[model samples]
Target: MRHPSPSSWAVISICIVAIVHLALGFSFGFSVDEAHYALYAQHLAWSYFDHPPLVGWIQWPLIALTTSEGVIRLIPEALWLISVSLVYRITLELHDVIQGRSSGYLTNVLPSGPSCGLMATLAVIAAPLPHVLSIGLLPDTLLTPLSLGLMLMALRWLRKERFSLGDWIITGVLLGLAGLSKYTAVFTVVALLMVFLSAKRKPWINQPGFWLAGIIACVLISPVFYWNWVNDWISFKYQIAHGAGGTWALRRVAAFIGIQIACFGPLMVVGVYFFLKQGWRNHRLTLLALLSFFFVPFTIFAALSGGGSLPHWTTPAWFCLAPFIGIGLAKAWSQQRRRLISSLFIVQIALCLIGFGFVLAGGPPSANLKANPMADLYGWQSAGQKAAELAHANNATGIAVQNWTLGSRAAWYAQPLPVYVLDQRQDQFDLWFGQLPLGANVILLNWSGLSYVPPTGKGAGFESCRLLDSLETRRFGQLLSTFDFSLCTNWRGADLVR
Candidate 1:
């Protein structure tokens, strides 16, 4: 078969990757974090106790457009475009390292340069997590682009051996943006430091640009720390508590590693080896990639210390290593089995489609604890709907839901009714609800657990609130079970309670 030009192959890779992700974005509902972030966006604040504010800020516009699932997903879909472009650029850059720009007929080394790009992009885009996770309004979408941007800039800085003040500013800005998107992004700084400190060429640490970049990153992340201080360090406590839940069973750790391999693909093994091979000779650049991997230790420490670490925490590790790995794969495959490389790309695309289809069909991914049997323990979307119906029957002017996943989804399905989120964590309900006039009909989707029965005394302030309906794990999907259960309200003057 005839070979295509390097540039042509890169284009083909990007198109396939972008198209696959675009489709995946349309197929799935917002995962839990996506829903949470979307709601968080609905009301802008400096930051959430659990995460930085970038996700909410990024998603704010999309949430305003339409409540439609597809509209909210557009942000993630858009990121895929940027991701693909960066992949192509990185691949081309990596190729140039070994096959210097002036080398004649570059075709001799990476004869199928464009095909190589195609393989790399497909490998990434075809992966289920990247596509599925990206589409939802989450931090990853924001982080992915910024991480890639930083990498590109880092490469340029590394190659030039001298970065201007502007270059440092741009690098710091991108890193800061990435940090806001996800805390794991702090690893990028570590990676850069390791590279600069170790690089034999120009000893990058002494340069002013390096310090400028560091200061910029610090400034960008200042808001997150500021919020933490104001909240009495509750965010830190919550994160620590959350991380403690995962036990340090060796099997679990092994399983988590296994999950990453399956999600990221076996090519990662090759990627690792490629780095090790290059690190042996090209020590400086290889160490930069290794530093990214060092983030896994941070994650493990978080897990072991009972600190929170999500599955995607290592995303930057894989992403930063992409360029070096791509070059290695290109070199090795060009000599050994170039034909199979395209086949691998095709398989990834196919897997992406199947994975998305399965999720849409109710075959939930591992990330969605909500889809597990424990969902009722969290909140039932269907139950929320039933609660809404009772509110309608009671002629309630507005229903007060706790304004979480269950509350929000209920509000979403039961539209047109004024729903107030008693976000007690923030003190809104406590401040205004007591002083404000009561609505004719009022229903409170309280979260103090089902045991807290409503007051039945004559002065209980409801003519009579009754248990209209209740929903639980056993009767999850059937709304009928929850429709009739309710806690009767106590009315001041009415004798209904008697």
Candidate 2:
């Protein structure tokens, strides 16, 4: 029996790296955003106000099988890992083709690449993964492959010219599913347009394959249209208002760019640039197709959009750039420079341990970072228990939360007690349980921080409000967050009372 070579070892190591990701999920609590997404599972639907219904639908089964946050997280993390694994697989096939397999049954079956698989595999491992990405249930997590697939599949179809109609349909389905995962995927059409419009490929725009794929994609994404039409197109309008505007916060735009650079790794600056040059130098039109996916989103959402928001909104495009980084670094550097890349990977693994270890413990060890942001995940179980106890003590008929985040936590922890979120923000909680009856006593949890201004909705919106006990969530002698658990008497409409 032969031992695994260094090349194969990288692929094998991915499995171990994946296990580390799964194990860490158990340590953190649901992110503020996660509770909201997880709560989406409670009220199943065809669509949602913030996004398409795919995320809710995806989370529903996993959320049902077990409430364990770690287990719930494993679903999307598995998808992300699968995407990486696919890229690694693609590199292997590409490598075989490039390295001189004149003709063989297996050789013909595999995809070939200009670079070896090891560099691509290692670069993906070294890339920074945000806490929310690793722990939370997010649509972007689901969007990973569809976006990458759209680029990779389209590139292969254009460059190789050996693909059949089935391959074209698969590309369409991936593009459609990408749209289902996130609105950003809509730009894939525009990218493909650039591919068709390319000087070399312009004549092929009249091809039936193009129209065939377009129709299939349209069919797959039609549900989004159906849902929005039923709900007066709120989803469409909401995305526009939420992501785009003339607020003109240059600092926000700058920060977004900086965060992306940090997330991709500073070394990627060299990797991505050289990769692009090589791709253009070799496969010009094919490289442009891959690039359009990255450039269009990054330009629109990060460079142009205003407001300080999630830098990860640009993640899918950045993710598509990974294989390039791997190949770029492989070619640009000498064998000795491998030490630097290895050192970076070691740092990443160390950070995963040290950082998550601190966060899992609910605090940092004598660090200036002060409180751990991951602690937000820490307090939900305790907060839910306290809310449940207070609801029982008040003889409250039901629970009402001021915001969706608190409402989701309440729903998860305070089960069997119908929890209603009476906020202006239109979430499923508000949609499903908006019917809070009149003359019913309700237990309201108002965030102390959000209380800086006058409380509205189920908070100050109540006719008779009595102060109950404030619940303090602490970990390791540090006060994480404080919640005002109030007993509001009489049923005054949250909007009406205010």
Candidate 3:
């Protein structure tokens, strides 16, 4: 048998990398967000109160086939496979072209470059954030492709001043699709536009095709806002609530940064290192422009918006710096530091795996529970299951949770038990549930509203059967640490003694 060359091995490695990504879903249970997205996909609305509808829309087809957690998650996992493939293709193209352009070497494919491509692809795959998130269906998965597609298209257009009619249409459609995936993707377009206009070396901003694409994207994405307007812009209000300190404190921001570092892994380290190392050089300007225009605006927006910021909000910024990191890594490997670089890659991947396990264990080792964040991953599923069990035990018609994010997850886990909210906010929990007749079949409550012994000294009309305590605990920096959730049952809750 003929032995495979290094090039052949790299190709096989890339395939293995893709498989590893797909295999990851099996290890993790569904998170609250995953459960929410899975349940929400069933409805197929034009838009949702919290997010645009694309994630739900994308996952709907798979979900129609099976409610299996792994099956529903596979859709995004497939997308991630495609994403890794795209990175491989993109990196190879850049390497071949850059080699010819900079060094006047006409090489068909660099043996070393594919390894670099694999590294970048693996960086994305094993980053711990997208990998974990991709394991659960969410808009971010859909956004990943759309966002990268937009960047790829922009790079192509930047390389070539003249945009063909086909390029214009495809770019426009993808940008609009990306926006549909997540509203945050709008910032991506801003970054792309800046790249085009500021390309003084090869300016293409004055072209009608460019503006045409921009207009088409706007026209396509406008319907989301129009739908929001028709619904009193609840989505807008939700965004505002999320952005404007609804859950603000100094500690959350710091935690967000720390999570991001873990999420991006070695890739983030190289990207940050490159920025500082190559500051203000001509080649670095592209990255600097991208960082300044996109990350700066988005960061300020996130800090100010304050409703409830998640670390993923800053994911796009890290993306802008990835290509630069790729270039830096290539330089490092070429300069005979391959062993050192390889060691770092191995170490980074190991840390990420350890962290991923920590999350899956339901809490971190540092925490009191020693359960990893991944444990919280399925607490909602468990909570919902518990609700169903109680309903089955009591021979009740249904069981419901107090109004919160858990309502959807619990109702979803509870299945045949319809999940209902008394009202949007907490103060009305009693008013809403109290209105229900005495001897209510089942009601589930979370840590906050359930544990409350009202100042007026009334229980929320639910007798506690169990706390459904979180086996996992998560600390989002020092600002806020959320207990996963527990089910508090009210067998014969109360009267609307108002």
The lDDT leader among the candidates is 2
The TM-score, computed over Cα atoms with residue i paired to residue i, of candidate 3 is 0.77
- Residue 309's C-alpha lDDT in candidate 3? 61
- For model 2, the stretches where C-alpha displacement exceeds 4 angstroms are 1-6, 90-115, 199-209, 276-282, 365-371, 435-439, 447-460, 470-479, 495-498
Task: Please identify which of the two predictions, 1 or 3, would achieve the higher TM-score against the true structure.
Answer: 3
Model 1 clash tally? 24
Off by over 4 Å in 1: 1-6, 20-28, 99-115, 200-208, 274-309, 338-347, 364-389, 392-408, 411-498
Whole-model lDDT, model 2? 0.67
Q: Once model 3 is optimally superposed onto the true structure by TM-score, how far is the C-alpha of residue 363 displaced, in angstroms?
A: 5.7
Ten-residue region with minimum lDDT total, candidate 2: 103-112
lDDT-sorted candidate list, best first: 2, 3, 1
Model 3 lDDT vs. the true structure?
0.59
Per-residue lDDT for 332-420 in model 2, tens only?
Answer: 55434666666766776576567667666666645322244544656667767777898898799788776666677778777767787
State TM-scores per candidate. Answer: 0.74, 0.86, 0.77
Top TM-score hit: 2
* Tens digit per residue, CA lDDT, model 1, 56-132: 88877767777667777777777767776787777666555445453221223453445455545645655556665
lDDT of 3 by residue, 294-376 (tens): 36545775575444566666555554445445655655556586786677678777876776555545455464322233435
Report lDDT (CA) for all predictions.
0.58, 0.67, 0.59
Error of 1 at 146 (Å): 1.6
